[model samples]
Target: MKIVDKIGFDEILLQLAEEASELSQAALKLRRARMGINPTPITCEKANLHLLEEIADVTLCFGILNLSDTEFDYIEHTAKKKYRRWKKRLGIDKE
Candidate 1:
């Protein structure tokens, strides 16, 4: 049986949520470290490494969720649209 089948979908979703939260925290920590805003200062390299680790964890969670091709395509489309909007907002849209 597949690992997801053994773990159940709900548990996997919960794990995804937890990993996403950790990713968010890692991003915040990296930002704070970069800005020198932390009371316990961390090296930028260490902060970046921590952020990378969290990103990997969240990515692994996403992989385990087994999204269908249609769902994956939709996400890619939406992400591209958002990227365009973001570039326009920043006055960096080349097209």
Candidate 2:
């Protein structure tokens, strides 16, 4: 096994997780606005901009993995599947 794999490079994943969490939090704030859950609702546009930046940060960390195209394809496929499932559960997706 490669030294990097042996080491597990966990720190990168930690950062990715942090960024992803921030993105999730931002999305939740937007959802609050849309659902009228907040008394003083957040601006959807500002929340979205923050979410976009967090998404970019997460993607940038992904490049540190140096994964092959096939690996990326697998990740993309699985992520899309999960997204679809979540969307369906939220009733945001008709089909």
Best by TM-score: 1
Per-residue lDDT over 6-87 for candidate 1, one digit per residue giving the tens place of the 0 to 100 score: 9998999999899899999889888888888554477778989999999999898888889999999999999999999999
Writing each residue's lDDT as its tens digit, candidate 2 over 46-76 gives 7778778888987887877678999989999
- lDDT of each structure? 0.89, 0.80
| Global lDDT of model 1 | 0.89
Best by lDDT: 1
TM-score of candidate 2 on Cα atoms, chains taken together: 0.66
The reply for model 2, stretches above 4 Å from the true place, is: 1-8, 79-95
Assess every candidate by TM-score.
Answer: 0.91, 0.66
Q: Which lDDT value does model 2 have at 95?
A: 87
